[model samples]
Target: MFRVIVRSSISLAAFAAGFPLSAAEAANAAATSEEDSIVVTATRAPLALDEVPSTITVLDKAAIDRSQDIGATELLLRTPGITVSRNGGYGTTTSLRIRGAESDHTVVVIDGVKLNDPAASGGGYNFGHLLVGDMERIEVLRGPQSILWGSQAIGGVVNIVTTIPEKPLEGSFDIEAGSRNTVSARAAIGGRTGPLSWRIGGQSFTTDGISAISPAFGGVERDGYRNRGVTGRAELALASNFSVEVRGYYSKARVNLDSTRADTPDYAFNQEFLGYAGARLDLLDGRFRNRISYSYTATERENYGPLRARPVSLEARGENRRWEYQGNIGLMRGVSAVFGAENERSQFRSRSPDASLARPLPPFANGKAEVTSVYGQISVEPVDGLTINGGVRYDDHDRFGGQTLFAAGGVWRLPTGTILRTNYGEGFKAPTLYQMFSQYGNAALDPEEAHGWEAGIEQHLFGRALTVVATWFDRTTTNQIVYTPDATCNAASTNPLCFEPGSTTVRTAYYLNVARGKAQGIEAAAALTLGALTLDGNYSWIVTEDRSPGGANFDKDLPRRPRHAANASVSYALPFGLDIGAALRWSHKSFDDAPNSIVLDAYTLVDLRAESKLSENVRLFARAENVFDEQYMTAYRYGTLGRAIYAGFRGRF
Candidate 1:
């Protein structure tokens, strides 16, 4: 099944690439305009993209609709300066690594709410299974955002903004089928009457994946995944000074994981369900804007495999719920301010239902966390063409205790159509439940903290026909955790459990107060317009050094991070209403192991997309991904899907 999907995806890419280019001849001219492009919500409000000082990328609706895959992670591949790492194959928990930052350090938000699992050990939000077809836009903010977004904003942020209806009774529905017996359906509806507006959407997808790979030590085989969900939202204009918008979304998905090295006969099933509700309000004579949000997430996991003949299995279930409220107040004209307070409470419970374990008859672990934070940001323009931004935040965590963050930055417009910017900030990440109390006996684990800054310049040429930006940054982190070997275990122990007694393993892994690391990098991105054609590309180079715990190793490469990565795309739109695009994404493979002992080969993927307006209200579209069918592994010891294709119809009324 997986093989078939790969083939179809390749075919689709070929067709899109081979489509007649003559139709786009009109728009192929080098003249273009960027004055009307929306800035982005990354600034906490709408601003022109060129006006914002930081590195930001916005995937507009057209780009979203034309992308080959509807999955959030897959769509992100189209963006520059961002990388999505999948655990194994498609539909798995796709992890993201941004600017050499760990997966958990990057925050993901939908609407105005954060989406991390407080109950999970890693405290990372998986983008792999997120649906993308129903979204209006996706914004990627690179660099540190702790001052603007609070904790866990070390690497960057990805904000998925949904579509809002512009008229009464607006809706769109799409159904597509291709290889792997894959089938998907998505629909959205929205309307407005008087002072009220609302929108709702739902999606369902399923696929029987390819045959398993090697290192098969488990009993399960066959790769398969399924998902379904719905989202509803409404906005109310209460009065001239007060308005509100509320939204809620829920989704559930199950995945089959390859646990063994060789197409193992065994597979693990991971199930997840998440929902969020949030509201926005305008207040204080149009000077203040407030938002309140809450979210709930739950997961049930079971691992089926073999432990030396006796059926080995693991089962666990957990949930996380949180609430946040914040407000931004604009005052003193060129001086706009933002302030907010939030509280989050979460609980987790996990039990081993497997009778194979010595103490399998009970729930072994349970934990909870309560967190609170207060933050504020101010933007000031002291002089014409000169803007300054500064902010600070304080947070209290039930586990790791407390921490503070501060930031300051400025942007100056040069006389020759060039912009110069610089910024410095501090960030932190609290240890999750797993790090604190999971099977490991680490009752003490401090939060990871860091300080960093960057300087950059942007240039506009040919009367905005071309744009260029370059930046250099350095960051250092400390209080890193290191695991050391315990000294009490021996094979002669009579007790059934003595921290690896039977294996003569007295070593226990615990979070230590030792370990430190530093990272430095340079990045450049550019966009050039020629007639009706546009070319966009970005490149990054990084150097990382780390000191492991127990003096075992120091100055080693950070895990799973590459020294260089790049992306490029070329798009053209014709006057007759036909559009075509092609893109190339490449990553220099790094290592999955801590000491850089293991190596994953680098890979490049080619994707193609096209759309033609059959009429004013209707259009035909198609896309091909991984056109080369390159054999690759995104993670250490895992295999990625080969190729895939998708095509469908779209319309508006």
Candidate 2:
């Protein structure tokens, strides 16, 4: 099945590339204007998509509404060069990987605020709780973007932008119910009044989910999950050239889980709060623009064990606060300069009955760390149809001292409606507090470093009705952190390096920066629009190597990363205000352990959806997911959903 999908996608790409120029021009004669889209994640300033020398994928509001997926991670799974691993069904722990990089290597941003957790084991953001209820747009930038987005951008960046009021009076609501006794609802209201505009919205979701652990692992009880969230935004236009905006979001979730020891039940409760305030000012008659912003994020988690004897509970909390100022100035014709400075402080706290789980929090002892950074970027079009961009950043960490990073890229447009783009950049990630202060901590550990490059070509045909792109990327990392047992001690001999010799105690392990790794991949994507029909698809081929020296898994494929993956979808609009769509996803076999001991088989899934307009202000929709009921596992002992159906209604006023 995987091979068939790959071959079909390649054929589509070839067809788009080989189409005649005369035919394309004739077909595009009646087509609408192909205005270039603007994106802010590629650089600090807004730039046209074609001018940015990076691989970018944008999911706008229309696309989000059409998919009808309840979770944000489901929408991201279809994107090229991206993959997701979940321990169970929806609302469980979820991790995202870009171009075969580790989950922590990707950075997530929500409305100009970073979402990584300082208290988590690897300081990575969990996507399990993120829903697409009030999102206006999402931009995914592929490659090393640390120069512009700071740490944890070694793989890429996922920037999420929320909705704002666009009219004097408007609102929308949706209600849905599905398999496994699931229920979901969302509503939003927004309006503009004089110089002030405001928007507020909320969502509630719950489900009687399947067991998190597979029955093969001795699990039989159903686990349930519930989530609730709210978001708000307000903006004031103080003057013709200035504006102030504030945004806030809150979400809480409780989920029933299966214990690692079969048959036992566990539960987790989590909450997140995010706030942002910013002001934008236009100077020199709009040629010079400046923005100042402050953002804060806090997260808390609590877990409880099964009620067999006495319940065990664990609690953890983390917070991040940041202040930023950015300026963009039009220095000359076709040239612009962007500069910014930021100050950030992060703290973490944990409490548990077990001393090993809560010792040595941070501040090294005070529970906080501060970082200050400054960055500058320049964009220029020295010649017609050619654009160039360059940037540099310097970060000063209170404990790790300072580091400098640089990035450069260019985009060229050919007369044949072909675009050539390339980029190269550096990325680094500081040691996490847990890595530095835990029982197995290493205070002297150095930060991990990475550098990579990517090049791609995009072609537009049929008057922009058909578009195709292909890209190749390579990245290498040094000083990667890994846990290793005491080198001088073995099961047989104690060489004095062993903390305890001639005792039955387990040997201690420590985090070391002695590993190197590399990942390379090729991605191809195509989109076609004709009359009332639309088709989109993408394919990715990735190769990842764990080159850690003296390791049993040396030069082996990284865990949970499939070598092949593909996605395809088709949608059609009929004459009676009705639409229909179908989608297919496939993945090849992959390993579940670093030593390649466990194998997860290949699997394919199909989904179908339909919607009809009941009136100008109302619509009805339904969908069937995993139509074939294919059984698959993204993790070794986790259960996945089977065939499920849902129906819903949406209304606007």
Candidate 3:
């Protein structure tokens, strides 16, 4: 199976390379050169990439389509120092780890709305399942960004922005077919006339997964499912430089699973859903900008089969709703100031209908949490080729009380197009509902906190044909919440769930506040342009160690994260209007469990894409993912998608 995957990957790569990927192709694909890209909100406002003072990755439209054959988790597998873990197959509740950071330490945002589920045990958004249609671009910023984004921003932040049409009409429809009987269709439309504009789209997909393990052994369930919904907009001309706009999206999916062993267990199916709605208003011309937005999202999970067969049978649900208002003023030609305030409410609930028939386990209590915060930042350019930025925030968390954070940074540009930048910041994450009020909850739990800093440089050589960037970052967290064994439980009971508590009948899992850890890493990225050819690559190395007092292994590595990762890709344009692209991804072995016990081996994979213009307004494209067909575990006990092929047609009328 692996050999076939590899051969197909190589053949596709060769085919795409032999053809030409033109500038128009790149534009239609939504890919961009490093030097020409711009990012916003990194410094509390819009800014060019080189001026951000941090390590960031941007995926333009072209890149998103190129990886469409794969799920969200697999698409990011090639990113350096990042790891994705899923239950078993596509659309399963996926989790993302960055630089060895915990799954809950990363924050995600869509159209300026934070997607973190306040009900999560650790205030972070779940990246495992998300809608991918209608996205204009994706920006990933590494390292701590708590000063501006708050809490879960400790590891980094992923911001997904959708495209807004400026014209009177525009739309596209795409249909694709691949292995595993996979089928997919996506459509989007947007337009503007006078002072009104709106956009919307959706996608549906399903497949029988590839075989990595035997079905009789409960390995790799074949038929899985996926679905998505999206809407967006911007309305201007109501008054010069003023507009009111709305943006929102919804998605749901079901996935099949196969355990590696017949007796291990099987959760044949799982499902998920998310919905969001918000509005943004631009006011006071170009001098001052004011924006207000609100969003609500929810998630639920269902496990299939008999009670004894499913050790963890149940229904779990959680939700988060937030409202924010922001203001930015251009104080001077080279200076700007921003201030914002926000309020958020969250809840989590879980129920076990079969606990009576099956072995009973401790249950989590339904709980609520709320937060209010005020933040501000300023940008300054004291001299030519140099910019400085600083910000601070104060939060009153209902569960953990008051917390404050601050950050400062600067960027310097040289005459040769080389630049230097650095930043220092602090962050905090309030304890989750489960930690404070659940069945085995600890009432005295405290918020987690961290301080972080980084330095980086970017250089362009050979007259802008080649670009390079390198960055080093480090962060330390305190008051980390960890669940230790309830020592009172004895070994004599046939059903271990019958263990008694030492001093209380409530039963205790012992939430310890005495935990500390630090993470450090380095990353490099580059892009090169030579004639009709373009090459891009990224590499990252990360290490995290627990250092809490009386810690078990202060020197051991973190779980579920690779110490090293690298990805490289090449694209070329041919004279006959043909375009070809290929990419290689590699990652070192890593552990899955918290104790760093269970291990997964290292693996590499390849992907290829080819496209050609069938006419002035029509085009044909095809892609093959998991080209190497390397069999590897996506999660601790689950199988990943096998080598798959996709062919499609896309065009605008």
Which candidate number has the best lDDT?
Answer: 2
lDDT of 1 by residue, 1-653 (tens): 00001001111010011010011110121112344333434456433344456666666565667664668886665554456667665566577866777777788877555667644556777776788757766767777787666667788887776666656788987777666777888888888777777789898988876544422233235577788878776766666545555566677676666653655545455566556655556667656767676666676665665442435455656676777676767788678776777777766655445434554354456667777888887888888788788888888887767778888888887779888888888888777665565554355567888788888888889986887878888877787654544455455654333342123334344455577877789888787878888888878887766754455557778777778888788888899998898888888988776767878779898888888899887788777778998877666656676677877777766
* lDDT (0 to 1) per candidate: 0.66, 0.79, 0.65
Best by TM-score: 2
Candidate 2's residue-wise lDDT over 195-276, tens digit each? 7778899999999998899777866888889999999977787887787878888999998887654655788898999998
For model 2, give the 10-residue run with minimal summed lDDT. Answer: 11-20
- Per-residue lDDT, model 3, residue 95, is 83
Compared with the true structure, model 2 gives a TM-score of 0.90
After superposing all C-alphas onto the true structure, candidate 1 shows an RMSD in angstroms of 8.0
What TM-score, computed on C-alpha atoms, does each candidate reach?
0.86, 0.90, 0.87
Alpha-carbon error at 616 in model 3, in Å?
3.4
lDDT of 2 at 644: 96
Worst 10 residues of 3 by lDDT: 1-10
Clashes (backbone N, CA, C under 3 Å), per candidate, total: 31, 3, 13
Which has the better lDDT: candidate 1, or candidate 2? Answer: 2
Question: In candidate 3, which residue ranges exceed 4 Å CA deviation?
Answer: 1-37, 210-223, 234-237, 258-284, 306-312, 353-355, 358-364, 490-510
TM-score of 3: 0.87
Query: lDDT of candidate 3 vs native?
Result: 0.65
